[model samples]
Target: MERDLSCSWRARREAGGHAKGGKVTSSDVIMVPQIIPTDSVSVGRAATLALRCTMCHGARGMSEAYTPNLAGQNAEVVYKQLRDLQLGHRKSAIMGLHARNLSDQDMRGLAAYYSYLLRETPPSSLLGQRKAPRIIQVGSPMFNIAPCASCHGGSARKTASSTLEGEPENYIRAQLSAFKDGTRHNDINGQMRSVARQMTPEKVETLAKYYSQR
Candidate 1:
């Protein structure tokens, strides 16, 4: 299909004709199919890549404290982060090295590979969908904290924001701590920092455990 498309596109370009009836433009480039199908990035291949990635992140994209778990995360999110790292918008020595060498296809493949991984759910999740913990469900009005569920996709729905369900507990704890300390300011308008600032240490730990178990 790709070969045929390429040939057709070349023929059209050489003939100086528009694409069928419509005008041809750079946007038409998207009409060309990728050499590799998105579905070809399988779990096994992802795991193999993860092995190369396991020094800091685990074999399943589960990393230690302060590292993110890539399993079951949104593919676009992963792709954007990789792009950011490559462009120096985000800073991480390890990620910068990995992203710098990757082509656009590699980023997409990695995204698809990690997005499809199956994460283990806690027993509570098996029973049924669960609600966010009280702290996440109801924001502290006095402190001007927004409800975490509103933006993080809540416990009931997965949002474009990173999915926290079944992620490593330590990672969540560390991130919240970072947000509180103003060390991590990636969130737009300092939203995470604001929310974390209002949360006590005990509350932060509670929120971490609540989502980790889900």
Candidate 2:
């Protein structure tokens, strides 16, 4: 699996012409062509043409390790993140480059494409409780941390915030860490940063596991 993943990324890099051995300049960024018109209902097709997104994010939008799964996410959340990447409200070496050439309409089209996909696996409790995760039930009032469910809806729905029930563990952990360290500040009014700053590593791990298991 590791080798296959490496090969997949390598192929994508080579396809982007980044394999040329030289300092990466601003002009080296790859720009995929938009195929479908924005007014059409073929936004998914357009996104596939503009960005072979499935090369990194799975075909069905299930993601591996550091990539957050986009399946069943709110279109608004996905579009906002892409916009943030493009506008520098969020920072990512790869995503920023990919987003730099995208227009607002393109971002929305791509978001719509991913948001409608289904997850590889439905989330379930590791202990078979079929109930909310423990962290969702209890929050540390001492740190002014509200229950996650308070912000993220309890059901399988997405809001301005992401739908976290089935996100990748490492992705969630990394984002939490970013928020804690002040590197990811896209959350409105620093809400995530505030919560993450008050959370310990252990708490972050627990939350990641709990949510990933759903």
Candidate 3:
């Protein structure tokens, strides 16, 4: 089955990277099959390349700052994000500079290597997901919003959705705010934007605190 790229990235590229007011995450490259190459060369290249990434993402792929952790992150998700940055579909000052010079193989290799690392365990202080707010566990269907867990809770997640468990509260809040304000429209099919738009700022704060510190 083929995916459509006419919406944003493809159109932008075809229009010489100047398609105005219709940007989206550049997931067009993964429309077909999505697989990370684990071959020795690819892995070695990725490992070597990761030397530059470790400054922010930690030597093991977990960041000490508010940045997203790359350890055990979904390979496809990481790959798409990098591609988006390279294609100007996503905006990040630091990442854009780094991804600007990365080749296709470099991106794939980096993504595969990061996913190969072990994930950091959540701290004991973190609260149980069961005790989360009603909107986080079971969304308000009256507003047509699905549970945050449906896509970001780390189980049976939708394609291309990022994992939110054990993430930084500040980071989660910022991204949620971005989505709510349409600043982060990279989410596939506007799923995140739609969900965030319906949530109140207070609800966003609550959700962030629950997912991060509980």
List, residue by residue over 59-100, the lDDT tens digit for candidate 2: 778878889888777666777678668856678999899899
TM-score list, all predictions? 0.68, 0.74, 0.80
Which tens-of-lDDT digit does each residue in 102-127 have in candidate 1? 77667666777787776656676453
The segments of candidate 1 whose C-alpha lies over 4 angstroms from its true place after superposition are 1-37, 41-48, 64-66, 125-131, 154-159
Computed on alpha carbons, the lDDT of every model, listed in order, comes to 0.64, 0.67, 0.73
> What RMSD does model 2 have?
11.6
Judged by whole-model lDDT over C-alpha atoms, candidate 2 comes out at: 0.67
Query: Taking the tens digit of each residue's C-alpha lDDT, what string does model 3 give over 51-92?
Result: 998888889987764788888887777887897788766779
Strongest candidate by lDDT? 3
lDDT (C-alpha) at residue 74 in model 2: 65
Clashing pairs in 2: none
Tell me the TM-score of model 1: 0.68
Question: Model 3, residue 168: displacement in angstroms?
Answer: 1.2
TM-score of 2: 0.74
Each candidate: RMSD to true structure? 10.7, 11.6, 5.3
- Which residue pairs in candidate 1 collide? none
- Candidate 3 lDDT at 186 equals 67
